[model samples]
Target: MEIFLQQLINGVTLGSIYGLIAIGYTMVFGIIGMVNFAHGDVFMVSTFIALIAFLALTQILGATSLPFCFIAVLIGAMVLTSLWSYMIERLAYRRLRGSFRLAPLISAIGMSIFLSNLVYVLQGPRNKSMPPLFNDVIQVTQGGGYDVTLSVKQILIVAVTALLLAGFWLLVQKTSLGRAQRACEQDSRMAALLGIDVDRTISLTFVIGAALAAVAGVLYMLYYGVVNSSDGFIPGVKAFTAAVLGGIGSLPGAVLGGLLIGLIETFWSAYFSSDYKDVAAFSILAVTLIFMPSGLFGRPDVEKV
Candidate 1:
């Protein structure tokens, strides 16, 4: 039971991180009706940015205040990745906005390929390790004498995720900008008719989503202490699945979806075998799709043709 609880906590922490990335995907799809395939690569880029910043700062500042340094690097990566997302929208996707849906999908794929190749050329497909930001571990002794261990980094991940999710909830539920976003998602034409800047809203959606992805990247690197240029691929796919699991456009759904996936993966690995983890995950995905095609939180999208 203690082991189960420990695993569940671990799963929740990991799931929250995945939820962050999944929110980015779902937000873009909800508002723009296109999947940004390059998003995962954007995550990879941000992680590299944080890793570089950490290394450089450590060399210059001697790594005394590791927490502050980590926060600063994460913030910088978020801003840069946000800008990159905006650029992707402007350079690649904006042109195909009102065209056939396939147009933007192709553009997304092309951007994904471009980012991957660009990273490979620049970073040379090497796996880079980042120093762990915190070394402190938390241990809890259960009534039955089982020791439960938790890393400071894991706690940080969960805390930061919760804070960010709260902020996101406020942004989406209370802010005027979020209303515009929701309006755009529901009906771009109607949003435009009502004087909303649909294009700018879409760009902002990309920026916000990318920023969250960057945060996820930082947490991921800190959690694993290593990152590769191709690291985002599997996680990205899983995040997308989470997005679909929770409800493609629903914010709460994304979180729920991510946590569910994380739990499933962790339990499968623990009980069965790591070798079959992926198979188990995809099998669950297939079952979910077969039974609940609209996802647990997804409402049927009504289209006016």
Candidate 2:
């Protein structure tokens, strides 16, 4: 039981990071109904940005104040990645937007390849390692006489995820910008007819999605202390699985699905076999789709006869 509790903590913490990346997937899908394949690579790039920025600040320049340095690196990564996303939408995706659906799909795939290799060329193919940050642990002992362990980093991940999610929810639900976004999601043509800037909205969507992905990238790097040029693909796929399991286009569903996937992966590794954890997450995705295709919080297709 104690072990279970400990794994639970780990799962939630990992899930929070997944949830952050999943938001990027779900948001872009909600607005445009297309998967952004390069998004995962975009996340990888963000991590690199954070790594370089952190290294320059702490190692090269000899700066103190860990919190401030982390914040600066995180923000810098988010901004750079957000620019990358915007350009992707503009230069690669925008021109192909209304064309054959396959055009954008292929473009995204090509972009993914391009970005991954770009990182490979720039940063080399080796895994980049960092000194551990936020290594403090908090221990808990239940009445059953088992000890459960928690870390400050884990707590930071959960808290930051919660806060960001709350702010994002408010932006999507309460703001005028949110209304414009929902309008475009329903029908881009109609939204444009109603005087909304459809293109700008889509661009903003990309920016926001990339920003969230950037945050996930930084958090994951901090937690693991190691990153590679090709590291984005697996987590990206898992996050996509999470987006699907939670129901694409639904914000809260993404978080819920992320947490569930995290728990399943963690518990499977702990009690069953570490080797099959990824397989378990994929299986859950398949089972969930078979049972409920629209996702837990997604709306059903309304066909007009």
> Residue 245 error for model 2, in Å?
0.7
Model 2 poorest ten-residue lDDT run: 138-147
Runs with alpha carbons beyond 4 Å of true place in candidate 2: 142-146, 303-305
Q: What TM-score does model 1 achieve against the real structure?
A: 0.95
Question: Local distance difference test, per candidate?
Answer: 0.87, 0.89
Q: Estimated TM-score per prediction?
A: 0.95, 0.95
Q: What CA RMSD would you report for each candidate?
A: 1.7, 1.6
How badly does each model clash, as a count of residue pairs? 0, 0
Candidate with maximal lDDT: 2
Candidate 1's residue-wise lDDT over 1-305, tens digit each?
Answer: 78787889889988998899999999998988888888888888888888888887788767768778878888988999999899999999999988998999899888988887788889888889866668798886546778788888888999999998899899988999999999999889999999999999999999999999999989988898898877867888888888889988888998999999988888888878989977876776677777876788888877689
Best by TM-score: 2
> Candidate 2's residue-wise lDDT over 128-147, tens digit each?
99999999988777566677
